[model samples]
Target: MSAINFTDVVFQTPRRVCHSIWDGLPGAITQTRAMRRLGRYIYRRFTRHTVRTQSHYTQFMRNPPLLDVLARLLSEYQIGSTVKLASIGCSTGAELYSALYVLRRARPDLKILATGVDISSEVIKAAERGIYCPGQSAATNGLYLEGRPELFWEDAKALRDLFEVQHGGTLRVQDRLRKDTNWLTADATEGGLADTLGPQNIVLANNVMGPMDDSLAEVCLRNVMNLVEPGGYLVVDGIDLDLKTRVLATSDFKPVLLGQEELWSADGSKDGWPWVRWGREPLDRTEPTWELRYSIIFQHARV
Candidate 1:
């Protein structure tokens, strides 16, 4: 080959490869993107395989802002009335139970029909069981509260009492909560999700489809939104920003504000005294220790 031809061939080969990679950047489906997506899928698949020892991800007081919004909603919806609540992807029932316990504490007379759903039968059964290790409670409730407890201690205690802590600290949720809350297994991605369960006054789908494809997430969210009763609330924190933006851009839905720091203050100020963080990681103890509090408490505009 001639000298110039040889040089051209070397440079041309790389340019084609570079062009191919850059091309994938813009389109929905690219070879590079597909491979990376497949890698992630495989990793998750394997991680799920070791479920026997894996700690199902969870957080304490996942979002206090939702509680604040709920409190406000109650006052406006009705001074004392029956409200329906549904927690999608309720995973082991922590979030579902938390909502029920907190709301019931606020309005002792208000009747709440709560539903908890997930895709995994084992997890649903575990949720139905309503049991958690002691460490689980301390991480969510203990560290987040840090030094303050009097304000929330009563409600926390009421919930803790509902558990029958047996030998080895396997806490079982008592009949009081289990009787009122229904647990089931259902896929959110399908159209049947709405028909399977009727409308709800408050629908929580947080941390459910975060790991799924954005397109799939959007579809599931839309289906879930349809199930919300008119003027009802929907919470989906785990969703992607793109999906949220597109979803909110529509006239049908409006984004709900999160109190954040406002939730911890006496008057609920975003720039206030009480923060949802701790100065130091405290040692383990019998009581729960709350160091870092929950992240954004997402909400949805009533339609």
Candidate 2:
């Protein structure tokens, strides 16, 4: 055998030890209030200097409760025959398509105009094609199906309505879902984005801000908020809660409490806990201002 690689072994040992400690902890202990507080403390200490990677991961119906609440809000509050929606940083069009499905299913009579925007030309092309192949990496095919595999199962007839199963197990977005939908390559952080897209009735900027630097994320959040029409809604998540709270406090937006908890616990936003830079903290209701801090959807005050 070659000489013992002590340097590599030493580095690997710490990871193994950390994993062992994590795995050894019981759910009872790990899920306790004290443990959660400790976890948050550790996360804050380490992630203060961390820089997050640009993620293109996405899935269909990643947050059903959010979409349901959005549809309900539109049906109740919006007084128009035409509804416009824009999904900024819309990775591979999965979330956008899911939103369209929910809105159309809820109110088929209304004319819906939807746009999916992403900075990557590659993802924009994939969104336009609307094709997802099985067993491919998200970077390769622009789909992350592992977390929500049941959505594609043959037995999941209701969820299956969203896609047309093609030859060799590929899924093509159905015509109904594709109709009146446009995909554009655009930088959401750039100025004049609001002018370019016009005011949208519902602007979704979810699962995209967490990886950005805090100051940049704040700027992007404000820019994205400007895309919303005066009375329209902005559905955002996956950012620093403190930053969000501060920004919303200064803005004319009010948090919508409907389905707030459900959206917080949704798949993409829920997992990894305090370890990953993009991971969300546990929803702590004991905090006095939990509702405003935890809510993922907010409606702008109508001028």
Candidate 3:
């Protein structure tokens, strides 16, 4: 049989077809075929983009509102004096870089070590290179308007100068870069997290919970909580869980509803395109945090 070009096949149809025919043997065969076709479609999409762009657009979002919320949450807790920050699902290093910039501006005197972990070696390599898409820089610059007026190019140069790409594969904040900040690639639930971060002041898990299954998300959260100092902060955005049940179980956690100024750019620049302040009402304390709102911030209570 001649192979069909998967790219020619559309995305929505297969997902629909798979769901529509998920019962009988013939239906199962159809579903299996659809899944293979879907995989090829995704592969084609991945191959068409540069690794850096792929990392930026696919791996994660450099959520401005979430970053601002983090900075505010840290200040509320005075995190700079106590907690170093660790980021889970830190694809291509934007989250770490964002945290570093916020911390530097918010608390220059304090030492901050940022560790960025991801499951993908490809993402880690792209992050180590420290390159960013032009649009990404523009977006970051727009987000950081309150602290630094410079363009994203200047910000990128500042970041490159401040952070050191260690030969050991860890990205450390060295010398002029505040000396205390750092980043690494590892599983958050695995053995090395403790060694890499010591104890964390703030752990930022942004928009990562939804991709993993429910059980994995909970385990990941527990791992992050384990790293926090008692009274240390845990800031989370884009939680993936049944908020009603999970929030009840995790009573110590507080949900933060971001105000417009805290999220959208008042300057009305399109540079921050998709990040424009979308009002996200807090979940009923049970659904996934991100499902109802575009973004949210959470604080882990002192144990």
Candidate 4:
């Protein structure tokens, strides 16, 4: 065999042992506040640098609670018949379409104008096509290798309603769902994005900012905020908690406390904890500012 890697040899056994212990702990013990806090500390100590990849990874109906909250917010807050929404970093448009589906189902009377923006032209093009094939490679479709059509949804009826199954199990987004939706390729971190996209009643920058360094993520967060109209809502998740809290502190955007815990511990996010850089830490209610730290949705106060 070729030369062995000393780093793996030195660390692998200890890591495995730690994982075994963690897994062996009963839920009752592991769920305790003290234990959770300790786990968070360990995670922070060992967290790796987030690698920014062009991998367009997403899932349909990823967070039902979040989508339901968005539906409620739009229904209660928006006035006119037409509602404008945007999804920055809309990879393959799964989240964007999911939002559209929920909103349409929730408020059938309102006409929705949606825009999906991504920095990758390839993903943008794929999103516009709205066709996903099982086992398709990133080279052909710009989707992550693990991105399968079946992962789009668990409910068969819902999948049938949203997509038209093509030859060989490929799924194409339905025409009604695709209507009035624009796909544009642009960097969310770049300035003047607000001017180009105009103000939106709801802006989503979810599951996309975690890979960037803090400086770039902060810049992107601020730029993304500009796209939201005053009194509108911003749905953000999967960014550094400290960065999010720090940036929003200076702005008029106040956290929406409803469903804060549900959103924070969302199934899509909670499972990755401590192991992945983008993973979310356990929610700690003991923290005085827990509400601000856990809330993923924010509303811009009207000037």
Best by TM-score: 4
Order of models, best TM-score first: 4, 2, 1, 3
Question: Which ten residues in a row are the worst by lDDT in model 2?
Answer: 142-151
Residue-wise C-alpha lDDT for candidate 3, range 210-265, written one tens digit per residue: 44455666777677666766556666544432432364254565545565335533
Taking all chains together, the TM-score of candidate 2 against the true structure is 0.84
CA deviation > 4 Å runs, candidate 3: 1-61, 76-82, 133-179, 191-196, 243-248, 257-295
Off by over 4 Å in 2: 1-33, 77-80, 137-158
Error of 2 at 261 (Å): 1.6
Q: Is candidate 2 or candidate 4 better by lDDT?
A: 4
Q: Global CA lDDT of candidate 1, please?
A: 0.56
Task: Provide the lowest-lDDT 10-residue window in model 4.
Answer: 1-10
**Angstrom error at residue 65, model 4:** 1.2
Estimate candidate 4's alpha-carbon lDDT, on a 0 to 1 scale.
0.78
- Cα error of candidate 2 at position 19, Å: 6.2
lDDT of 2 by residue, 1-303 (tens): 112553354346664454367557998997788777666665665543467666677777878888988888876644448999999988778889899999999988888999999887777887788887644433444423223232344433556788888888777889999999988888888898998899998999987887778888998999999999888999998788878888998899998998777778876646665556666777888766687788899999986
All candidates: TM-score: 0.61, 0.84, 0.53, 0.87
The alpha-carbon root-mean-square deviation between model 1 and the true structure, to one decimal in Å, is 14.8
What lDDT is reached at residue 274 by model 2? 58
Question: Which candidate, 1 or 2, would have the higher lDDT against the true structure?
Answer: 2
In model 2, the Cα lDDT at residue 189 comes to: 81
